[model samples]
Target: MMTRYIAFLRAVNVGGRQVKMELLRALFEQAGFKQVKTYIQSGNVIFDAKGQEAALEAKIEQLLQQNLGFAVPVCIRSIAAVQAVLDNNPFPGVIPDKDFQIYIAFLQTLPGKEATAIIATLQSDIETYHLNGKEVYVLMKKNTGAPPFSNTYLEKKLKLVATTRNLATVQKVLSF
Candidate 1:
């Protein structure tokens, strides 16, 4: 049976690097995936495949490197798993558009003690982090782009591959 999966890709369309989302969907289809659909333009792809998770991830990564001409980190999560990540958000009570916004950065696994300790050190600066399984929930204040809250810093501190999107973007992606 084919299972639904979401591939969150890093560094797809950013920093003036233009990669069309349609091209991304086509790459997945060429890689033998079905029902391929891309959400927004931040490289959120949903499709169905049949195989072990590790093999699937390797296949997709290889396909990306060959087709996109660059190494793009891919995080594959089941549709159900993505839904659970959205549902289990710990900062629901906070105003969504006010001083609170959540971003779920998918990871391969929980960070080790050293990496996680480094990430914990930066938790007190206007950002709340909740590490749930292979996902990190970030609740940032009104201005996300300012101050110490950013995806680049968090990824560096945690030493893990990650891609982040606002809660609204996340919900839109899940709806597909």
Candidate 2:
């Protein structure tokens, strides 16, 4: 049976790399995905296909790399998995606003105990994180500039591939 998945692509349309949403959807459709749709320009693609998550991720990464000439990492989650993340909100009653922001880092795999320990050491007053399964919920204070840490920092520290999306974006993707 086909499964519905949201593929969160890393580094799309950022840092000099630009990917048109139309092309993205076309790529998925050409690869046999059904009902392929892209949300915004940040590489959020929702589609239906028959494959395991890991296999699907690898396939997409390969397809993008071959076409876009850069390594585009992919982290996919089923609709149910995405819903579960919202259902188990770590920061309850905390509404995101101008001063505060919430981000969810969708990881390729669950972090190990050592990685979790590293995360504990990285938490601070400005930003905090909660790890539930493969998702890392990050709460940060909006400042004059960008926050000290980012998805790249998390990937380096956790030693895993990850793609991050704002809580609002995740919710919007779900509605697609």
Candidate 3:
């Protein structure tokens, strides 16, 4: 069966790298994806493809490097997977409104034990995180301004490529 997938791309449209979403969408289509749709410009591509998520990840990364002239690490999750992420959020009562932004950072791989311990050491009142497999749920209180547990911090401490999206954005992607 065909699956609706969200390709959460990392290192796109950030740190001086410019990638046009329209061009990225065209690459996905040229790579054999259907029902192509893009969310924002942060490299969120929702497309329909048939294959294992791992294969799709590799395929898209290759296509991006070849066509876009940069390596974009992609983490693919199905619609059901995204729904499960919402259902599995560890911070139950924290509503993702203007006051708070609940984000899920998709990791390149499951963090190792050492990395998990390091992440645990980063516990703070402003930011809270829970790691489940390759996904990390981060709750950021808007009162804190910029979050300490940013994608850069997570990638640096965990030594993995990570792409984050707010719960609100995930909900919007599900609507597509």
Candidate 4:
């Protein structure tokens, strides 16, 4: 049976790499993915395919690199898995506003114990995070400058590839 999966791609439409949503959808469709749809320019693609998440991730990474001429790391999660992240609500009663925001970092793999220890050290008063399975819920308080932590920072500390999206973006992606 085909399973619905969301592929969160890293480094798309950022820096010098720009990928049109239509082109991304086309790549997935050419790779035999059905119902392929892209949510935003940040490279969130939802589709149906028959395979395990890890294998699918690897296949997509290869496909994108071969076609786009650049390595695109992929993090695949089942539709149900994405929904569970929202259902769990790591930051309870914290309404997102201009001053406060929530971001979910979708990880390529579950972090090891040592990595989790490092994550613990990265927390602070303005920035806090909760690691739930392969997902990290980050709560940030907007201050004078850029936030202390970002997707790239977490990836470096954890030594894993991950893509982060605003909570609202994830919600909208699910709606697709």
Instruction: Tell me, by lDDT, which candidate is best.
Output: 2
Candidate 1 per-residue lDDT, tens place, 1-176, comes to 99999888887788775789889888899888999999988889999999866678788889988887888888888889889988998887875776667777787556776765665676766777888778888887766567735778778778887777777887888898
| Alpha-carbon shift of residue 53 in model 4 (angstroms) | 0.4
Any idea how many clashes model 2 has? 0
Taking all chains together, the TM-score of candidate 2 against the true structure is 0.96
Which clashing pairs does model 4 show? none
lDDT (10s digit) by residue, model 3, range 16-67: 8899889988888988899999988888899998999889999998888888
TM-score of each: 0.91, 0.96, 0.91, 0.96
Over the stretch 83-108, how does candidate 4's per-residue lDDT look in tens digits? 99899878879888988899999999
* Candidate 2: 10-residue stretch with minimal lDDT: 141-150
In angstroms, the error of model 2 at 55 is 0.5
lDDT, residue 31, model 3: 85
Task: Report RMSD (Å) for each prediction in the order shown.
Answer: 1.9, 1.2, 1.7, 1.1
Q: Which stretches of candidate 4 lie over 4 Å from their true place?
A: 146-148
Report the C-alpha lDDT of model 2 over 68-104, residue by residue, as the tens digit. 8999999999999999999887998889998888999
Better of 3 and 4 by TM-score: 4
Segments of candidate 2 deviating more than 4 angstroms: 144-148
* Full-model lDDT for every candidate: 0.81, 0.92, 0.85, 0.91
Residue-pair clashes per prediction, in order, are 0, 0, 0, 0
Q: Candidate 4: global Cα-lDDT?
A: 0.91
